[model samples]
Target: MSTNARQQLQHHLRNARYEVLPLRGTLEQVQGLPPGTTVTVTSSPSKGTEATLDLAARLRGSGMHVVPHLAARLVRDSAHLDELLSRIEALGLTEVFVIAGDADNPAGRFTDALSLLRGMEEIGNRPHRVGITGYPEPHSFISDQMTIQATDEKARYADYIVSQICYDPNTIASWVKTMRARGVTLPVYIGAPGSIDPSKLLRISMKIGLGQSMRFLRKQHGVVGKLLTRYTPENLFDELSPYLVNPDYNIAGCHLFTFNEIAKTRQWAMETADRLQEVPA
Candidate 1:
């Protein structure tokens, strides 16, 4: 990671920049977390967009910055999009992570993110920060051109991006550069897995989407995944540290996919912050 990215990480640590709690029942656990914590919620096709409203309300009531994921794949129509926006307004949520959710097929009238972005505009709802997802590795179901196109178009509607969780820092770095080269300018929040056990993380990854994760692990044929069994994000951080220090890269902060281990994940961040502070100034 660059020094700028490292500094950004430190700042994020000061404010608890954790994200993406799609795991079951983590909403309540994260909502009750101490002050200044950041919790992001995810919406899936099976659960529908209503999940964002319910969870955002629960988290806001607990006095935390709650970011709700507005999955485009689950919305039924334009009016349905309006309802989700109204609920977000009533709940005072200013940020949302928009993505094409994991659905075997389009769940409703919408199948992709552009539809939701257009719908958000038609309804005149603009959250303070809107985020989209980027694929560091090839998406199993999407071509590189389609992925880049989706990002380019989404950038017009989004303020920033939260990339897919990538095990390799080199790949993440390369993807960011490729995006920049492609003229996608939204600031990026690089996704990293938290301090969960590798086995559990792998399982959770598959459970969620595994778009590229299963492919990566399967291609590894065993050695890498075995080593990763004890591995956490320490190595990934080492790869990103330099970029965190570079402003031109527009690296922003982190999006930790806690996989619902909020307690342990938060502890890991706090401890990491302390360790960073203790390092030579």
Candidate 2:
């Protein structure tokens, strides 16, 4: 890539977040990030939001700008939402990512991200910035039309979008175009799978019902091959550079789903950051 393009891409990388599962050793691995790098904690259905909050607080105390996923379905009511916000506030956290969560059943009144965002606004608990989810590939359960409409509505309340895992750069570019055409113009943080065991990634994608995306990955290898047994975002980032450098797209950065494989992922991030710095503007 040209130096200008590489530099532009680096600009986005500077603000990207290293997304991780709120599991053992999360804090230690996240310490690898340079100061000012954001760390996003995922909300696990098995562990609930408590783990996310705990990790977020720890990271914040350690000087990282932390963003914890506030799973709307896990929250019980308005009071619960208030308390969560209060705790986040006490820690001086000003950003959050809201999601509908993985729960098959809603825990209370808020069924989706938009509902929770509205609830926060109603209770005067709006964080400085809020993020919402987006899907570049068609959602397995929701219609494309519905996804578009819901995304359009959510854009009103959200400051940015962190897309669901997507491997196909063309598909992502097209989806960004679609979002722009439909006026869902929130700053977009492209979601890419972190360097991970391909088998584990396949299982997680399948469990989340991202069968269509999985099929796309399979087709790239020509049939159901083991070529996806190990994966990296390097190629995806190369494929996405055009859009990433294009100012009109308002593409903010990447949100890496590290799957808690932080050591390897941190190495990759550091190497890439070094390259970004070496390139002349």
Candidate 3:
């Protein structure tokens, strides 16, 4: 590996953010993370937005920088949005990730992230930094053209973009180049799975619209076999290393979808950083 690639990988591993789901043991798992670590909390249709905000507040109290997900379909209306905003302000959080959510039915007026972002703007107490999701592969429901156009519109309000977890580095790199070509200047955070079980990863990935990427993985002989034991983003990092230091990619490190496997993921990250540092320039 080139020296600059190694250094860039090390830098990303050291500063990567963790994405955790709201569950029974999630808080305890996150508490073990190093102080000042940035943790993004996910909002789901089942848990609702309240669960995300509550956990975010607690995580903030624990000295971690928390970015809560504000799912558009979960919010009832302007009043609910105001309440959530009030709690976030009270917690002094300045960052949030917005998603359209996987809810089957609309909760209220806000049906998508763009609308919720506009609502936040109208409400007048928006977080300083807002993040929106990007899809490198085709969404399970939405078409590729629609996803790209939606991202372009949301870019006006978002500070950054966290791509959906993708298994292929070439697809991701191409997506970044496409976005840049289209004049979307937002810094891109490549999303990849952390150290996680293959079974669980597949189930979750299929659940969240990563079908195309999953198909790609299946086509690669022995990839599934290796993942059957354990899955890590090592290959992903190595494959994307060339773009990490390239200015055109505008890569802003990584967003690890830990799937609440915090300890394993953190250990892998630390070890990887050490291994990269030991490499000769």
Error (Å) of candidate 2 at residue 138 is 1.1
* Residue 4 C-alpha lDDT in model 2: 61
For model 2, give the 10-residue run with minimal summed lDDT: 222-231
Encode model 3's per-residue lDDT on 154-233: one tens digit a residue.
99999999999888888999999999999999999999889987888877787777766767777875565465455679
Instruction: TM-score each candidate.
Output: 0.89, 0.93, 0.96
* Residue 100, model 1: Cα distance from true site in angstroms: 1.4
lDDT digits (tens) for residues 1-281 of candidate 1 = 44455556677665655764554676666854686567888777666667666777777888888888888777778887788777787788888878877776775777788888887888787788888888887776778789878888888998988888777677788888888898887788878788888887767666556555555555655554675676667667766788777665788777787777777777787787777766664
All candidates in order of lDDT, best leading: 3, 2, 1
Better candidate by lDDT, 1 or 2: 2
**lDDT, candidate 2, 169-213, per-residue tens:** 888899999889877778899898777887788787776677666
For model 3, state the Cα shift of residue 134 in Å.
Answer: 0.2
Quantify all predictions' global Cα lDDT against the true fold.
0.75, 0.84, 0.90
Which of 2 and 3 is ahead in TM-score? 3
